[model samples]
Target: MGFPAGLLVLLSVGALPCQPITHGDSAKQDGHCFQVLPAEEGALNIGRHWGAATPAATVHIDMSKVTSTASSFEFRTLDPEGVIFFGDMGDHDWFVLGLRRGKAEMQINNIMTNISVRGGQRLDDGHWHRMLVMNEGDSVRLEVDDEELLALGHVSYPIIERPVPEMRLAMGGLLLPASHLLSPMNTAMDGCLRRWSWLNQTTTWREGAALRAKAKPCFSALRPGSFFPGAGLASFRPADLAGGTAPPNGSWGLEVELGIRAPRQTGLVLAVGVPDGSLALSLVLQPTAMVVRLGNWTKLRLPLPEGPCLDAPLRLRVSPTQLALQLGNHGGTLPNQPPDFQWLQGTWLGQEGRLFIGGLPDGDKTPRPQEWGAFRGCLRGIRVQGHQLDLDSALFRSDTIWAHSCPGAHEGAEAGRRARGHGAD
Candidate 1:
């Protein structure tokens, strides 16, 4: 079938192929242009004085792809960073826009005052997002995908009192002093960026503008190549079950091989039981120990040894009579403590129940947001009733959970399928 006219036009204007522009491309080119910022490497040096010429400016960026991994203050943006617009020689007087804690933020600091505005939604979901920042007079407004964020007004005056000799305008990161280069705060963004412009009047950044880097950074035009680094998991509704029904005697067993990425902070890693009721078995990761809950009672709180959980695989085995926890060769077991309620002693099967790994199941089938309890890190294996299930297949096919598996771990299996153009499912 022929491509629709409107769709073709849109693709041509914005969604250009991942083509690299070298330093020899052109001395100056214009209109609807993009430059790739290699993950954690390379940046466009768009002239030291590019944006220093104007203060009342409008900036638009088509973040073609964002691969932020975690919600912590780590992941930074691979966008138009570094002296975003204007800054003084002292470096304390400047404005910059970038990502923090998975959200976009714009900060303006001068000799007199410092102000910052943060976006409402997180933008690390491996998708293209549009961002606009406009500074008119004393007000600055930020919009993400057309949604308006809180605007800043009465911004301090004298945006830049005096001009600096070498004002830097970097695309992937800021120009920091040599002493601060290795600091955790100095990490570069790890994603693709394109269609960035600064001005009320729309004009492409000149392609050949002596701003290209001496060596091009490696580019992965495909999706940000990894799983979500924070806590998240998949859910299986009662209707999605494929194996024989869950054991009906309330004496079933579950075995899961997972690695804890972060110390648990009041979160549920795996849960199985009926909907909206207290009758359930949950595995929780805590700061000091691993907790297991049956109904309203705490069955066990196994203390963790003094070492990183990532050093070895964690194996958990659960049944009505006992619970087992193992890290590498070390292991521990405790008798199951039933809740006071009689219903908890009955079979976990034969009802409209649900199963969740890496998170609790929401009432409906759709995946819940990350803010809704999710697990972090990797799940190496999961088995129920001695039947091993493919974690990758379940994750790609399930609708009730919001989990992601490590791409590196699944390289031999699903990753090969994905490279062969197979859908995740």
Candidate 2:
């Protein structure tokens, strides 16, 4: 019931014996900085080598000022021009951790197989985040802010198969050229890095004065709700509900406020339907639009304007005859198409199925895989059938209620109600 022995020792030992590498005032957050490698040249070499003899390693980085957008590979390491950890082993056989289409990804190539795991949220939101990458035995784990983003097992092949090359740790820029066979490494990161540690060794700006001078102070606060704490948001299926059904009958409306972090990926914000995947109403977020699927065939796609919606509250309304979407003050509506069946009528929510929010339900009424469009943002103030959902209910808490209060909740809710009424027939 007490603290673990290892944890207690770590706490009692205080700081590691590694020399402190400081620049300017270490006490001031903005006073410390490290520049990103230039697009074509430049790198901060750690001047250390890891090989078969040292197959297990851990890296920690404190990053601030990430760009809003990402290149083919968001953050790369191990070479002057951001080649993967071991580019000499062949591009397809190296271990890489970066962003793929805005999502954090950890990829491992073992000559015969390529394995990757993507995080549920985006990591390039101009915030200060702590990243940890660990290679222990046959597995690799990538974590952001202490949350496990991705983990891969049986990845010991590369460390064992490839010859140990003289490789030093580097950040940003790519050593390889862009080609169809290889993923493009367009531009390096535009951010500040602090307190990077590898295998218990820490590096600071003092070690690289030139790079430190080029880095500007970045005091921008990280946007809230970028990463959910605890278990994050809750997801539910019909069976999870008390009655095994919901929204029983009458002219009911569904409303929810979502803080979208990544709009480029497709995700299921909410769904109500049967066990066989037949949905009465399904709301999805696409790269540039909000898609509403009614019944089986009717679909409404509302395109979002070209701009950043990160942390922007999106309100959605699903009524008997129409679907309304509001992002901030911008709103749009599309009438429910014809051939309306019982599923599209008032009592559809009572059907023998489930209600899923922040994700889709699988056959057994559990959260589906991320590839199946799991929502990647914060959800709150869910109202269905005129009843505001008790997000703090025991059932939802067990399912992970990371945080509450969607961005601009009061305004967004008001706008949602107004937009829902204004767009009605």
Candidate 3:
């Protein structure tokens, strides 16, 4: 099924439209560019976003096949700062394709010397462009759309003497920030990428069978995964999770809905930001009710008809005038005025930032609310503005976020150990 309008932020880059092609309609391989989202600014090691880390589209490279060959790809974009591609040797040696001030740039570096050359053609003109790089033992030839952009190389610099046996080749970003040589402009490319080829000699990156296993097409497509909380944490950028322009009133709406399944009945369904001050906001599930906390201490308890043996849906919606909460088949709506809900008037959803879901790690530096206990349950079919947050696209998360299964006592203890260690660090 298609994504329900929201969460497309994690799926899409700029607002460029995509033209999906049919198998029989061989109009052209290189057609309208598919929009891609930039990689969320996150730690490369502990953070992994869904749908490939950077360029969104990814394919593996069998380094042994094209150990000594060139790389090429076609792209269409108006962004000038995203990396077209990056490959490195786990150190200072690497090769990169990028745009600097709208001009195509190619750089290759090693422990010894580095070479960089730019193309005269300005390519950020909202049109398709092809980049070809042929590296031959230091000397290189770079081209754009079949025309030679520039060529340069150094005697001591060899891009990757022994490249990683398998490397994920991406469109406009690296699978991970695996290089110190990557410049700030080497960030996620805000454009479309296609026809990527390298490392493997037999077929293109898309057509390769073994390599294709690890790559994802994009995050725009919809697929539901369950969040079984344990020692793990998951979060999404507020902008991406609530994928909508602010209404003419200049106020963004915030709504959170979730499906609950749990062995333990207590859990923090979500926390918008740290639970402090007027910015603190969170949703929590208890044995008897679902608690909605707004700002420092104001709370509205949505009591459930049955105890928390919940295997049903729960939704909470907040607006300038009213608040609504639902559990399974029972729920209520209240006006956002006066005595009980004056706390609801603050428009802090979008401004509050990251939405922390499931398990929120507790450390000495960032001790979470004790009532905001780890969600020892599975949260599924999560929807915000009809869109579902991608578990894989979390900006920062705890390790071992399992899908389809809940962690047991042993796992929980392990998680505690890990959290303690993380807190220590």
Of the candidates shown, which would achieve the greatest TM-score relative to the real structure?
A: 3
After aligning candidate 3 to the native by TM-score, how far in Å is the CA of 17 from where it should be?
47
Q: What does candidate 1's lDDT look like per residue over 1-425, in tens digits?
A: 11000000001112223323223322121001112212212222221221122211122222122121101111112222222232222456445555555566665555544666666776544334565655434555666667775467666422122233322233334444423221222223333344443321223233333233222222322222212223345555533545435555544455666544433344566766655654466777665676766555546677766644333456777665677788656778777664422333342344555666666544664433344455443343345444444333342222212122222212321231232211111
Task: Kindly report which residue pairs in candidate 2 clash with one another.
Answer: 81-173, 81-174, 81-175, 82-173, 82-174, 232-402, 238-354
lDDT of 2 by residue, 262-301 (tens): 4344677767665564557777777677777766666777
Report the lDDT of model 3 for residue 324: 77
Model 1 spans > 4 angstroms off: 1-233, 238-251, 263-266, 308-311, 337-347, 361-373, 388-425
Candidate 3 per-residue lDDT, tens place, 267-303, comes to 7778765433323567777767778776554567877
RMSD of each: 19.6, 18.7, 16.3
- Highest-scoring model, lDDT: 3
Whole-model Cα lDDT of every candidate shown, in order:
0.40, 0.39, 0.49
The parts of candidate 2 lying over 4 Å away from their true place are 1-233, 237-249, 337-341, 344-348, 362-371, 385-401, 405-425
Sequence-dependent TM-score of model 1: 0.39
